[model samples]
Target: MGSGDGALNTPRWLRGIWVIPLAFLLVFLALPLVVLIIRTWSGDGWRILANASTWQITALATVQAVLSTVLSLAVGLPIAAVVSRYSFRGRALAQALVTVPFVMPTVVVALAFRSLLGSALPQGFLIVVLAHAYVNLAVVVRIVGSQWSQHDDRYARVAQTLGATPLTVFRTVTLPYLRSSIISSSVVVFIFSFTSLGIIVLLGDSSTRTLESQILRRTSVLLDFPAAAALAVLQLIVICIVIALGAVASRKRGQQKPVRNALLSMPTNRASRTAIHLIAVCSCAIVLLPVFALLIASVRSNSGLTTQWWTSINAIDSGTTRIGSPVASLAQSLQFALITGIVASLVGGCAALAVLAHRWGRFIALFAIIPLGISAATLGLGMLLAFGRPPVDLRASGLLIPLAHSLVAVPLVVAVIAPALRGIDPRAREVAATLGARPTRAFFTAYGPTLRTVMLAAGGLACAVSLGEFGAASFLARTGAPTVPIQIVRLLSRPGEQSYGVAAVMSLILIALTLVLVLVVDRLGRRNGALRPAH
Candidate 1:
């Protein structure tokens, strides 16, 4: 199929979609980093780069990230196997529950850990590693499970018939098949832990400090922009190296034979069935326990269980000193969510369309995801340096938070929409054009329904991201109007029963909102027929 037949002929106006995303990225994503580098170089940023402590922190964080990745893989692999390969009761719910912690605000996860295990475990390296594993469970399950579901178990069956033990079969057969996905997921989880901010800030000690935390302290506390910039540059270089390594590791060696579709089925033997169900139940419990603890903490106080915290969400004097009312923060979060949803959907939708409409569409799509590799703290600091000041002050306008969120969200929107757009048969547009429709009209005729569906799905996802996003918002959010995640963090920083209770209440609210947004997105995609089965 030629480009004109299989791909729509590029309309001049359709090609214009690239302009918005390009401009958005250039202004918000690229400009900040350039400014940061220039500012740092003008000062003593290079000296800080050579400081022994800087390299020491990088080394320590790399080790910590590796440990976290190993733990996440160990914990998440079994859950991924059972949920992805079997047809069991509540499988969808199990999958959804596994994802909750990942989508929850990092600060909330840190607090939940502190509430659940702070008394039991010391605030240091082990606790930090555990928290990192918890937050990245979804990365492993989603990435590995998607691949595992498509794997033909017949290979394992064939190996079993050849007298190979289950462990041996997994080691030689299944492991090789999943190597790329495993490595890819590991790199992602590692990057997240390595560049961690909220979890480290709450759970880490001197021994566990990551480069991200160092950058924050250098910028906000010490007022040393040069040092912060140097750390950011070092962190960015490390991130690039890790990503490059992942790309090298994930490259396919040879073309493998295609396999037939294998639908999920219940295990036949009693032992196997029991084992699978047990794993599923345990996975759910593991994910829900901390959340359950938070819920209990929100209600219970020194006197007894009470609804005071819930009722006092709106109270101005809700026991927090620096943080404002939870009610006001909630309102602020929703407003930001709305703006992020609109901006991300528009920019990301255009980027996705550009992939099909322009000659350099794939390059544009690739560039859009750069924000994923950039740490939230890095992005926040860069934005602070670029726009937080007088020449282009965005702080007072109330748009910085949403704009930062949109930057974080644009990649996800592209991920969700690009595939859906590709799944659409270009021949449909050709048919519409044959009926005397113009290229624009024909393009809409073919793609409008799926576009609307995925845009809404992507928009809801962006809203969810905005609700839980903490890193950039911490640097950018105004003092009087903190978001929910920021409010939760501030409340947790103070010491008091009422403070903890209110923080718990806010965390619960944030959790509820995030889950609702995700569920709605899933439902909307399913209803609109935009969700296709993976091959």
Candidate 2:
């Protein structure tokens, strides 16, 4: 019965792609971390390393990450199952909505959650877990959902026909097929939750502390650079271990062949289809609720749904330095985002190109992703210690926030572009070159258009990242000119109803801005026909 429809084994030329990716891992991924390790392991690093509190925080963070991972999977799996395995109105939009929290600045999400639930739950494990789940919903949905969509429903049907109940069929057949994706997504979510910063700092307490947050505390509040560096290194090592385990688990081995189907036909019956549709809608609503709440808070006030928050943003600080206008923060954030968009896009784009241009390109690409493993606070502090001083004070230049944002975003750009690049057929380049097209011309003729499309998508994504970033900004943003998230955090930290309302207003703007960015990118990707799932 094997008609040879399975994916072929790895090809020779394509095998070399791994080299570039590995090189990237070494350069961008490994080196800063190695530097972090070296700095942390040096003379005074051991003293901080010996502190019992440090280890205690680490243990707490590990538990928090585990809980976050569990909650994320529990909620995200059902959404992934419904959205990926069925077709319905607004399906694409729903899928895109799931990704919103993942990309929003942790601080922004924290503030939104605080506004929505902080009154009831306060800051601790439960609220933190909810926020983590919200942020990571997309990771599970996109990663596992892609695999779920391609699963052969017939296999489950056969299992059911063989005296198996629905639960039995799922447990025996469907679950096994999704094991790799679940493991992969779990690892990613664990890492994100483990390394969390802005959310924990703004919406957490001792119970929800993460190494990433601790690293920041040591570096910024305690001014203990060595200790912070050490924590950063430890975090990196743990992340690498988790990632390695994921890699081993996700390797294709004895897996069933993928059975692609149109999105519309996967559900078993009308009731099942209707159930999936409702799940998709509810999931999307869940994803959008906090954001919509922010929007409502922004507009609605004691004056009975007034635009005072929007209109009085500038005058909110007319005569006092107490709370600078929310509008001012909005402008500052936008400017910083614009700079971050250009800088990160260029650096990340070059890093992506380097992967394609040279044999050692992968190393550079990996180097770019290292920022992901490093805590934002650690990066922010390192940049501060290294450059926020006498001869090299970038803080005054107003470039610090943007620079930090670019560092945070470079990894994402690589993630978005590299996979897309891998999907392009290299044979098209060979064909063009054979037809007398010059090397550059042939390259452009083959991959240029796709590159443009993905770059725009990546750039928009980077901009969104920059706009939402808070951890780094907390370290570098000017005292007077805080970014929106920073301002929101500041307002929330203060005690007043007006402050809370204004912070909500700021959060709403952030939500609108992020949605627009995502929609625009999705539109462009669709127009260029690059919205297909990455392989």
Candidate 3:
């Protein structure tokens, strides 16, 4: 029997996994959006769409996002070429390091940049663009790098042998091969920058306002839900257009033949070797500098280096009335993380299983990724409209934040688990069934090992997402209980040395927690033989 036949033979219990994800998405994702539409329909939301300021902000954000995309590509292309084309000592570490900034909470990144360039550079359009580039560096590297690594280098070698210079060969041959990936990555970076909230909130001025920032302002600062809803809808429409354009651009060319993994070799000439090493070192330094600066800011005070910020983590009054105790925030974050991990894994795992067992699985999988395109601010506002008050008030209930977080995390969980599940051989399950095992037993026998590893990995990732999430949490979190990111933003808003120091300390704690979770996920995946070294 074919793999599809075997998958179809899955037990009744196994086939029912789709229901959980379907129900979860309907209740949490679709319902909230429906509520948002209804609420906006009842208000004067439609008027805001025709406002000149809205379109002006959209135009400016597009310009900023374009600049950020261009800068990220310029910086990331070389790093992607080095890491993907040539494997060297510490290459794995280098690739992992590049990903760190991308996974960091936007609020943390904004704070780190502020602390790193204090008084040296002023926050404005340029600073915001640079920060956007920094955070999105990984998207370019990973997307373009994966394609670059698979690229057949024989074309470049042939060009060289025919009297083409290195630069000429890159321009004529290498660029064409990487064009699709470059476009794909650029589109993703643009969307991120265009809809950005945390960075824009912290670093932007009048010129850098995004539709997302305007939504937050309207909802929180102005209590203008109708206008916020209008902006959110406009932002979503723009994002959809951009994503559609990217999809079309990326698929314009026919698929290239898959190439086998090419063995990495060290550069023969001294000049080439020195350049590669320098790029690698510089990449590491660039990624680490802001983090190191944050670390320094946590301990150093006006007088001198001290443990004051760390010690004051548990105090309610840390020289700020607007901020709460760091200890309380930490506890709140952990609680939310634990809940998000379980909820996301369950929902996402089921979605993956459904994809494996159903004929419509591919469609379902595609549908599940819809959240990835939705901005966090948009999702937050939807959840607020749906569950924040009245008929289905869930604001005081602790489930609201975790539910929002799970929505954010489900896409990631599905991405990680679906691929691993699809790769498992179906024949093992047939063998188990022939040995007289039950359908459930046979299913587990074939896929249990991988499911366990990926679930743990997915759960860990969910925890990390909950810990660093700022946008949705900003909408859902109560004033008394805030997540770490929320607390940090509040501290930064207030002007006090103690507040800054404490925020720094909290940021460091968040960084450490995020890194540990990711590392644990990597290790777990490796142990289960799901993760392997990249070529």
Top candidate (TM-score): 3
Q: In model 2, where do residues sit more than 4 Å from their true spots?
A: 1-39, 262-271, 300-304, 318-324, 423-437, 531-535
Off by over 4 Å in 3: 1-4, 252-258, 316-323, 531-535
Better of 1 and 2 by TM-score: 1
User: Candidate 2 — worst ten consecutive residues by lDDT sum?
Assistant: 1-10
Candidates' C-alpha lDDT? 0.88, 0.76, 0.87
- Regions of model 1 farther than 4 Å from truth: 1-10, 255-261, 316-322, 532-535
Worst 10-residue lDDT window, candidate 1: 1-10
* Pairs clashing within candidate 3: none
lDDT of 2 at 190: 92
lDDT of 3 by residue, 431-451 (tens): 999999899899899999899
Name the TM-score of candidate 3: 0.96
| lDDT tens digits by residue: candidate 1, 366-453 | 8898999899988999999999989899999999999999999999999889989998998888888889888888889999999989
Clashes of each: 0, 14, 0
lDDT value, residue 288 of candidate 3: 95
Candidate 1 residue pairs in clash (backbone atoms < 3 Å)? none
